[model samples]
Target: MSSWQIGDITVHRIDEIPLPPETGAWLLPGATPEVVARADWLGPSFAGPGGELHLAVHSFAVEIAGERVLVDTGIGNGKTRANPAWHDLDTDYPARLAAAGFAPERVDRVLLTHLHADHVGWNTTRAADGSWRPTFPNARYLTARAEDAHWAQGELEPSRRQMLDDSVEPIRAHGLLDLVDVAEGGTELLPGLTLVPTPGHTPGQFAVVLSSGGRSAVITGDCVHHPVQLSDPALGSCVDVDPAAAVRTRTGLLERLAGTDTLLLGSHFPAPTAGVVRRHGEGYRLEPVPSA
Candidate 1:
């Protein structure tokens, strides 16, 4: 388990699947190999031997004050997703969580930054009876009200809708959902953990802020995916709903976070995902913390 300490809270990474290296252009539209190659800092961790960008789909276990809060639920095992890469995954995610000393029933809260299919895939799991059920029966699911309302308008593609029906709706049906407003900042999740709005990738996307012992960290849920984006804040992912707005949100976030003491926990970044964003040249760069 990859773990980090920010004040009193302890964060552990529970990986569901690791995405293999791919050319920068394949993942982000404007990100060509030439563009990303300039980021010399990404080598060996965020990027591979051939300027291949590495990524992972995983959730962070945030433990603090007798609470075991899962930041985001990764793509669950045995599910059909529209995206082929995520379809019918059968990884030992629950077992991996147990290996990290966290059982499903012990989770207190399943907090989702948005309702993206990847982020909420493990909200529930498939049962032997061929029915889907909440994976963490003892936990309450938390998401933004705007996210639920956005899907309610039926603007998403069929695949996303299927994600809602299978992974999201089951949580609501089991009376384990709490929808909060993230328009003007966000609510206090715990005494020291706050949800701050970082919209544009999704209508109601938010990042978690942890403050304690004069140290801080932010769980950036899709606000920024890979370290390459930090080199060119204008570059956006093909999956971004509003590319232009995403840039604004991302640039603003970098401006506020760059050179600060706050550690950034990237949701989809590869190993050693926790880092400090620093202003570089005309953009920014991630200085990864040495892992334990």
Candidate 2:
């Protein structure tokens, strides 16, 4: 079990599955094999010998204050996604969450970084009657108000609409979804959990900031999908809604994080997912901190 501690908070990594090499190739075309090979600091953990990136689908089950919180549910079981890899997954995600002490009904809050198919797939589960229902019936599912506003103002493609219908809409229909306005600074959801605005990957994307005592850790949402972004924030993903804005958000975050003790946890990073930023040449790199 991969776990980490920050002051009084305990964060558990609830594994869903490891993403395939193709996922890296498709999501980040800019991080080609040649480019990866050039970054020697990436190997042995962040990248494979063949230069394929290492990524995983998992949720952070956090015990903070008195809340049982779940952060970013991974590509869920039975989700019919546009991406082939995310389509119709049947992983033991629920069991994993339970094992990590975050059974669906026991969750107090479901924090979504964005509304992407992967991030929201576990929002609902298919009922026996074939209707999607809120997975955490007792928890309040929260996301940036900006995310819903963006979709409401525009027409989503069929696939995008399908994802919402199965995952997001059901939660909203059941009155379990809450749209929180994350200001320029951030909105503290609870004692130690704060929603920090991080747009661009999606217009209303936000990273979760967990703090307690004097220690702090950040859950990097989609703002920085892979560690390669630490090398060059300009290396954006193919699905970025605003490429330039994503770059700016990432660069600013990394610049501030560099040389700090603040723990940087990559939402999709493989193993040793928590690290502290450090200046490396022109950009930055993670000084890996192994989980307990």
lDDT of each: 0.86, 0.89
Model 2: lowest-lDDT 10 consecutive positions: 147-156
Candidate 1 regions off by >4 Å?
A: none
Error (Å) of candidate 1 at residue 282 is 0.5
lDDT of 1 by residue, 115-195 (tens): 887899999988889888999999999988887787789476788878899999989888999998865756787887899
Which numbered prediction scores highest in TM-score against the true structure?
2
TM-score of every model versus the real structure = 0.96, 0.98
Clashes of each: 0, 0
Q: Give per-residue lDDT, candidate 1, residue 107.
A: 93
What is the Cα-based TM-score of model 2? 0.98
RMSD of each predicted structure: 1.4, 0.9
The Cα RMSD of model 1 versus the native structure comes to 1.4
* Residue 87 local lDDT, model 2: 88
